[model samples]
Target chain A: MNFIAEIDVMPLKELLDPQGKAVAAGLKNLKLDAITDVRVGKHITLKLEAADKATATAQAELACQKLLTNRVIEYFTFEVKEA
Target chain B: MNFIAEIDVMPLKELLDPQGKAVAAGLKNLKLDAITDVRVGKHITLKLEAADKATATAQAELACQKLLTNRVIEYFTFEVKEA
Candidate 1:
């Protein structure tokens, strides 16, 4: 079976997101005032050939832990679906 | 009201994702062959002050258009929820 995993990796909220802060400041400069509290993260879409959804989920989680994220400063969540 | 917007920005499937290709090669080097067809993108969470969901969605869409994405090579989608 083929599955698609939509994974979100974000800096822990307690951590300062320099990118987000810079973007927020940039937007403010542009006079876009309605938006705030910006946090930037990675949206990774993985295509997995697995035996089942469980296996695909496990593979996605393993990828997240090993290659996709910096565990010390970031956390992740994902949704899996058929491709 | 405050609303949260979860935005996903990705390279159009028709476009080549060099980063994704590089990561896929690296994963293969690690002998993680079970995962394939990886696509990388951005996950942005924005907090917006709007009168209602409709307004929040509008603001988020505008931000995506103006700042968060490069429309020439990438495309985006988002979900907005009350926070």
Candidate 2:
């Protein structure tokens, strides 16, 4: 079976996101005052071969743990579906 | 009304994503060979004040066009909900 995974890796909310802060400031400068806050993260799309959805989900999780996120400052979530 | 927008900015499928290629290579090095391909993009979470859902969605779209994306190489999609 083939699967597609959409993964989102975000900074821990407890941590300060400098990039997000900068963007917020920029938006303010652009007069987008309605936009009060911004948080920036990574969106990753993966295409893979798996035996089943469960295997695909597990593989995606392992991939996130091993390569996609910094456990100390970031967390990740993902969903897998047939391609 | 307060709204939260989840925005996804993705590289155009026609373009080359060097970062994605690097990650794919790294995954292979880590022996996660079931993963066949990868594409990476930006995930942005925005908190904003608006009068209604339609207004919030319009604000998000404007923000994307004015600052968040370079239309020549990327495209964006978003969903807005009450915060």
Candidate 1 segments whose C-alpha is farther than 4 A from its true place: none
lDDT of 1 by residue, A21-69 (tens): 9878877776677788899999988888989999889888888888989
TM-score, structure 1 vs. true: 0.96
Each model's lDDT comes to 0.89, 0.94
Listed in order, the DockQ scores are 0.83, 0.86
Deviation of model 1 at B42, angstroms: 0.9
The CAPRI quality class of candidate 2 comes to: high
Model 2 chain A is weakest, by summed lDDT over 10 consecutive residues, at A25-34
Error of 2 at B82 (Å): 1.4
- Please give, for every candidate in the order listed, the TM-score of chain B alone compared with the true chain B: 0.95, 0.97
The collision pairs in model 2 are: none
User: Cα deviation of B83 in candidate 1 (Å)?
Assistant: 0.4
